[model samples]
Target: MQQGSSAHAIVVLARGRARVERSLLSSDVLPLGYRGAGDMAGESALVGMESYTENVIAMEDCDVVRVPTSTATALLRDDPALMQALVSTVLQRQAEAEERLTSLLFRPVEGRVVEFLLQAMSRWGVPDARGTVISAPITHLEIAKAIGSTRETVTVTLGVLRREGLLATAGRKLIVVDRDALAMRK
Candidate 1:
């Protein structure tokens, strides 16, 4: 959550057959695109950024961290460590958003998927008996949402990458077999 950034995000789940669209404007609690289980957004207000966003923030039975601008700024001056953590979190989130925007706008779908996998690999991968494995569970739908592609597209692309020996999904993780090849797509 960045200071002075007026965006509202709520972590909600699908109640019916409605698809959840991850945006700053949507109010319906449905899983449409990238709203995974326990997904959260940190912001104060919601402005018209995109139609995918919901105006109503449906945060029921969820922990909310609401920080007033004055309080936030005061904390920044009073607590250096807390200020650093908040700044780091906001910067990382901004970087990720920029990365996703760049991939979706300038690169091909394959490149976007590859870049996403590599980023995840760098973030969550750890050495194990089988190889460098991601310790977290990630779904194809999440990958699609991250890369601005359809779920089916992510599935097909993953299949193609797997067949080419560039990537693989083992257990709850996605593994990159050839980092060079994946980077070459960039």
Candidate 2:
């Protein structure tokens, strides 16, 4: 769902992950965060929103179950767990937004990119002898969206990061060469 159009249903991400974001008028993507399997999205409809608040782009192949707003609202009323889950999801999203805004105000593009990579590492990173490998597949454009930058800028910044020995890429994955050094980059 895009920013303005409400998806009048609850999206149960049953498989894979999705990038949650808002498409800016300038074509810059203000990414909120990610939604993984078992996470529920598009709950704004049940919360009295006129439309879906954010655009959810699949990070990979995904399978989803959509529950109509009316049904989901009824379930929300009868199911305390569901309500709690929704509240938690909303709160987490809010926190991510706040963090992004803070980064935008105080950090440069490189810092933002580094921070993004570090955060991703903590989320889906796999431990290996070389360093922590971010298992999730991400594209340069997605990185730009998350950091509110252009893809070309991201590409160049990544190159600089690599040259500095702070990061590396294998296949479609990003490997943090030195977590401590990379974290100190900002």
C-alpha local distance difference test of each model = 0.58, 0.88
- What is candidate 2's lDDT per residue for 56-148, written digit by digit as tens? 889889999999999998998999997898889788878988998999899999999999999999988899877889988989998998888
Q: Pick by lDDT: which candidate is best?
A: 2
User: What global local distance difference test value does model 2 have?
Assistant: 0.88
TM-score for predicted model 2 compared with the true structure: 0.86
Q: Could you say which candidate leads in TM-score?
A: 2
- Candidate 2: C-alpha RMSD to true structure equals 2.1
Which pairs of residues collide in model 2? 6-51, 6-52
Q: 62-97, model 1: which lDDT tens digit per residue?
A: 344444445555666799997677567557767877
